[model samples]
Target chain A: MTEEPFRWLEAIANRRDYVQQQIGTGSPVFAVSLEAGILLLGVGSGQSKVFEIFDRQAMAALGHPADIERVRQMLIDAAHLEAFTRASADVNVRRLVSFGLSPQLKQSFEQIFQAPFMIDLLLGEVAEHPSKDVLVKVNFDGGFKIQHGGVMVAAPKPEQVTLATDWLKANLDQKLKPESAALVLLLAWNSLTSGTPLPEKSEQPVKLPDALVEQLSDKVVEAAVLERKGSNVARYVPLMPLLTG
Target chain B: MNTGIAGDFLGLLAQNNLRPLAAESSTRAPEQTHATTVFAFRFRDGVLVAGDRRATAGNVIVADDVNKIIEIDRHSLLAIAGVPAMAFEMARVMQVSFAYYRRSQLQPLSQEAKVRALARLLRENLPLTLQGVGVVAPVFATVEAQGDKVVPRIYFYDPLGAQFEAVAFAASGSGSGTVRSVLSFQERFGEVKPSTMTLNQAIRFAHNVLTVASEFDAATGGVDPLRTVWPVIKVLDANGVRDVEAAEHLDARKEGV
Candidate 1:
């Protein structure tokens, strides 16, 4: 059986893992100017979930943790407006996302006295008229690019992208199921953390079970701990009941 | 970091050796072309702002298609009179100011705040207005959120930036007297309530007033069907500000005007 049925869950898990990695690193290495960190949009369905990751390091650098919390609260307060279905038909979703973030960024500039920080966003949607599945990358400066039928990464180094793309090409088929897509992303994350060489391609791509995927996610977190703390131990935040239940 | 985006903007301007206009200036330039006859009124949903297309230098008609209505943001509209150039510049700056605030703050300004900001800009331009070289009268209109409902707020400003909030309607420029008279007549005898008038009725009323102003005042240009150069009319409501296109004016044009 293909992993198509579990794609949404996998996408959410992928975002959670990526955010965890960034937080573990204690640096905003993955910060993009795309408003929220990641967004999963069901194209024609108009269903979407936004994963907003607040960068502790970035906020700490700004010397205003309270301000960061305030910004997050503001985002939560305005989350309804940021919903995909709330966007006007004439307006592009990516532009709407930028618009949603503009007020907070403006306020930060006014109150925090810092330059605009980068916001990263990933948008998944199904396009009508043309009838295509699309994933869009959006930046804080209201810039965006569209991607189709592949895993797209934002704010990654050249080497990381090269490795991730290599794994993606080798493993992903034209009709990518959610689990396989998540596995490909996991392999890329594994490569990034392990600094290991890319794996050789086999005739049949390996299938990753949900349990194994979780284990691999844990491994990625462990690697982050080793890199940051010189140990193989790390603490993981439990998934929110709203998300897990 | 900064107390507000406005302060930062001023700081940046000063850093670049630019200064905002003072309440009074020491020097004045020669008289320039000034636009006339812009007005706005509160209606059922929001506010309707209308402006004549004529620009005049004394008695001479300098231009016949000057747009006096400007949308500062999605929710706010500005109708300008007096020095066309200065008014346009003020509108442009106001647009950027609102956008900058929204972009940096990630939220739109309240309607009252927007009107106050425009008034402050006008006050800063007082020096030029005092010299009679850059006089501009602007009527600002916006729809504001209050509790569960939204209401329209309109304000008109003088050369020195004194802002007056209008409960029902406001008018400015050379043809204001004629427009005011028409508005007063409509309020006194017209069967329709000004506040309860539908969007269509409000627009037609503004057009009729402007048409009358054109008959009495050369500075107020009436509708030109052949050229399709109608007055700038905009509506600011729950859906935001949008131009009432010239095509929409076809049905609103007065007969035998």
Candidate 2:
């Protein structure tokens, strides 16, 4: 956010520091603490945890009295407690959502996914066959549309693919600014044409492109996301880049 | 728009003493309530988002062909799973909120920032959360640049203002738990899927998990994918999120990422 760092090192540093700042001094559990959770910002090794939000005042005074002002400021701003209340009372805290969904979530998936215009969405839902559990037909009709923001690099088809992998492989890797890598990935992921199925289930999806494959997870494929009316045999087809991604 | 603000929003509401519900995780809902099935999965480069078309209030199906996937912007997409009316309103507000963020920041918020903002919004909606009427619990999956890797992350939220990172994948709404178990087994973690797998592979994954869940769990609906029109499936890869049609699965062997 500051000066939009161009070089990889500087950009990455900015990103890392910014994320750390955002992490701040909060509960390690990410729970909903009504009171302050002390942040042990010092780097914590596997043995010691770094950065936590503490709720005690007297203890904080005894532990690090020099940070009392900072702690008070945090208590006031984060805990929304009065200076006097934060300092005077010995506090005990509990998490509102230790084992359940956060109270902050309640909207549908559509609203949650589409918050970036500079982003692209690939629509890929296919159902119109029989349950492969009972049927013998491998009828597959896959359709997935791509919608993207203004084009920085257009790849309507494989010929037009400007994906980070494609771009970087097409002798542009050296020229690409790290800032544009995100855009390239966005473009490739939103490709309108079909290419290959994802690599989670098969070994081939991993070999298609180094840049793309490296980023993907090695999670095993479940038969949960797909549908086969009855045929155990699969009828493969090309739908969109998202499917092949 | 990414209701990253949902948490903060709910927290703000709760601070004001309003009741909010974690609709996505509401096990206490009336047995006869509209049920929506939603899920999110990380792809090679992007994230896939999907939902069913049926809304059942009890045994009666009130709506069919309800597309849960919505396009919020060019880069991001949203798939909703919750009370329909409440889901719609939350989606609407979230969309407006993105515009608000853009206006305030004078630039579109980063994808990561969007997630946090949506979390905050949900947190601020806490007042409404306690009264059994809450909205905004949805699984958000996206491919973000974490160093050189474009790692896809799936974040699941709770009405009480908490978040958990879902590894591999996550399913929400009425039939998540049962489906999650089934998916855990069905998910292909070891294979190179991007080039050799088919859309049906993903659908089969969804169908297999849903079928197993629906067969045993009363909450999860049975899978009719490929029966009627299969449920909409999208993939988020480096290419971005796109829908996968049945025909696309035909002869998809030759294509590569």
Highest TM-score: which candidate?
1
The count of residue-pair clashes in candidate 1 stands at 25
- After the best TM-score superposition of candidate 1, give how far the Cα of residue B147 lies from its true spot, in angstroms: 2.5
A179-222: candidate 2 lDDT, tens digit per residue: 22222332234232234422222121122355433433331111
The number of residue pairs in model 2 that clash at the backbone is 190
DockQ of 2: 0.01
- Our model 1 lands, by Cα RMSD against the true structure, at 15.1
Q: Which runs of model 1 end up more than 4 angstroms from their true locations?
A: A1-152, A155-245, B1-8, B20-28, B254-257
* Native-to-model Cα distance after best TM-score fit, residue B66 in candidate 1, in Å: 0.9
True contacts kept of each: 0.00, 0.00
Candidate with best DockQ: 1
Each candidate: RMSD: 15.1, 23.5
lDDT of 1 by residue, B1-257 (tens): 22333423444444444454533454645557889999988778788899989998878999998889987777888899888777877886676556445533446666677888888778777777778787888888888888878888888888888889888888999999998787777776878866778777777777788888999898889765677677888888888887887656766654322
| RMSD (CA, angstroms), candidate 2 | 23.5
- Kindly give the number of clashing pairs for every candidate: 25, 190
